[model samples]
Target: MENNTIIKTSLDPRSTFDKYEKRPLINAVTTESYEPKPQAHNSKIIIESIIHGFDNFRKFSRFYAFMGLVAGSFFSSLLAVDNLSQLFPTFFNGYLQYIVPHFFMHLYIVGLNQLADLEIDKINKPYLPLAYGEFSFTNGVITVASFLFLSFGSAWMIGSKPSLWSLLVTFVLMTAYSINLPFLRWKKSTTLTVMAHAIGMTTSFNIAAFMHMKTFVLKKATTYPRSLFLATVVMAIFFAVVAMAKVFWFCVSLLEIAYGAAILIGASSPFLWSKLFTT
Candidate 1:
């Protein structure tokens, strides 16, 4: 009887210990599942914000603006070619056949911008498609190549003497700007480079004229009838003014100076149909 009673007591202690363990385990499970509802709600908001931010990110690309500027520069010059002939009477007779390639010159400017600021763009413009790992260098090459091909091809098709020569000059300038601007240290040669770029910018307007007239030399005319001459002059002045204005608006640097000059000068070349407005 004593042995049986001792066995029962030991078994009874084990049963109690098991019951105690079960209660703690049940409490732990309940505690773990009982998270505050607000935390779950806040997590959903975080997820939503991330999604929305990405949507906004795509809408803000500046590539469109850059492309527009390139296209505008080309089209505007085409408009002025007819009137430019009035200013330089012999332009068509002597140089009319070379204007076909003039349309592609803008590519030189855009390419130079891309090449010069590549490293800086990677850091300052991390959000840019190129830097964000969204766009590949191959894509850039394709884009530029397509622009050149279209512009030059169209110029070739036009078969205008001036257009062809203008195209050649543009190609050469682009090559020079891409290859030698760095050697000239145009970024560091502030005034001299700015003036050279300005001359190039001003020349772009004439190149556009070449496209319209299909020639480069002006004939011996007393006065050109088109008011576009005045408009070209005005745009050139305005572009120069804006170039200088950059000093007041932002900190001046080699890159800024070179680009500011480029933009202003390039901007002047595009004011097509100036006569339509003036008269």
Candidate 2:
């Protein structure tokens, strides 16, 4: 419709045909020459890519969820306080060794899940790096692979049996939950999906982290103290909510309400008993 656009296109045969066909976009985008921006040095490109990779890793990994895992590990370790003096150096050193590899394992699992659910994520969680196209699929594969390598390699290097088992089982369950391969992709099955996450969270996060502190960090014999009930509470509170996020918002809300009510009831029970006994 603009005189400038029509006059410009009238000169070029290709543009003439486009006008003859009455293309809507003919006037929409001006025929501007496309030029590639000046190339950065190869080393610069590599550095930028590395920076993007780290940013993508941060985007993909849930820091709050990861911190919850860390908190679980921290408290579980406290459950195994055999000797106060051991807390000074031995416990701190051993906890770091367990945590470092676990962090890598956490990245691998979350990254792998995002990679596998790229298409679904565009619908469910478009803000995710992979879904948003900020992180390419090829780079996702590379990052996840690197995390997997670091997870197991560091665990083995430290010669920690608890960390080894922790990473191993978590890897297997996460693979089952996310990968699209045959007999995998447990997310397709309601039963398998819940089972995978329940076991993964309860066992890998709850038991493994607890065991790491009890055995490796504190050098204590494996014993389930009353304090270890904290792990069970964690499993009950967190496991289903995350795993069931796929299913129904109602269920997630229900679990939250139930947990909140339980906390209130637990807190009030002592006062209720005092009234009963006094009466």
Candidate 3:
């Protein structure tokens, strides 16, 4: 009887409610999901910013590749200037001084475009930082302004007139291309947009690059080579076409790449024929 009474007492429901006897409540702590601050330039933000800023990193990569080839295919200038083993390093150093600053300028250019095209991008390219709401308008403004200041300031510091001019001209062009204010938004006008983009991307970039390397690196008088002129013409059309295709088609297909290749080859054929005849 005593044993049964003890068992009954231990089994009491009120006793089971003792806090001390309670096992740690499984998942007792309520978990709340956290959404990141929209404009925070934290790790995720920084990564997205970089991805956006440096998107199509090839935009400027060809500058180096083409210029490097122009300077020398094998440890010397096409004119056979020697001591290039040492001079090549010098060339790269100067190139970086000029190109690195322009990188920030490129960032500003692309960011400004995004700011103006947020709605279109949401439907077309939602992964963009601003389009997806990861970046706010204020954040976009601040970042774009900072990049602009950095690019302009650094170009001035480099003391290269060609470099500074390149940044200035490209900025003005891109600003005009993307800004929505009256008389400035070239994107609304197909002809104006194409003209501005082609000129800004091709003539400005190529001519400025040639001037920089020639005057700054080769230490020579500014002279435009035939090949350089040819390059600008071809690349200008290519860039314009690509821009249109990308904006309208939303992607650059392999067929477009093959088309570009054919264009390049066909465009060069005339020059090749003339050169062959002359040589």
Q: Compose the digit string of candidate 3's lDDT tens values, residues 1-279.
A: 999999997898777776545544533433444567776638787898678667533331234534432332122122222256635677667667767677788778778888898899899988777877767889888988988999899988888887788788888888999999989999888778778877777644566776776676667776766655555665666667755764655334534654565556455655777555423
How many angstroms is residue 200 displaced in model 1 relative to the true structure, after the best TM-score fit? 3.5
CA RMSD, predictions in order: 12.9, 12.6, 8.9
lDDT over C-alpha atoms for residue 3 of model 2: 93
Q: Give the alpha-carbon lDDT of every model.
A: 0.51, 0.77, 0.67
Q: Candidate 3: deviation at residue 171, Å?
A: 0.7
Residue 99 error for model 1, in Å? 12
What is the C-alpha lDDT profile of model 2 across 142-236, one tens digit per residue? 98999999999999999889789878888998898899999999988877877787777666556776788788776678887544554565465
Which scores better on lDDT, 1 or 3? 3
lDDT value for model 2: 0.77
- Model 3, position 114: C-alpha lDDT score: 83
Q: Report the lDDT tens digits of candidate 1 across residue range 5-80.
A: 9889778978879988899999999988955689898999999988866753343333443343344344444443
Error of 3 at 146 (Å): 0.2
Candidate 1: C-alpha RMSD after superposition? 12.9
Q: Total clashing residue pairs per candidate?
A: 31, 0, 0
TM for every model, in the order presented, reads: 0.45, 0.69, 0.62
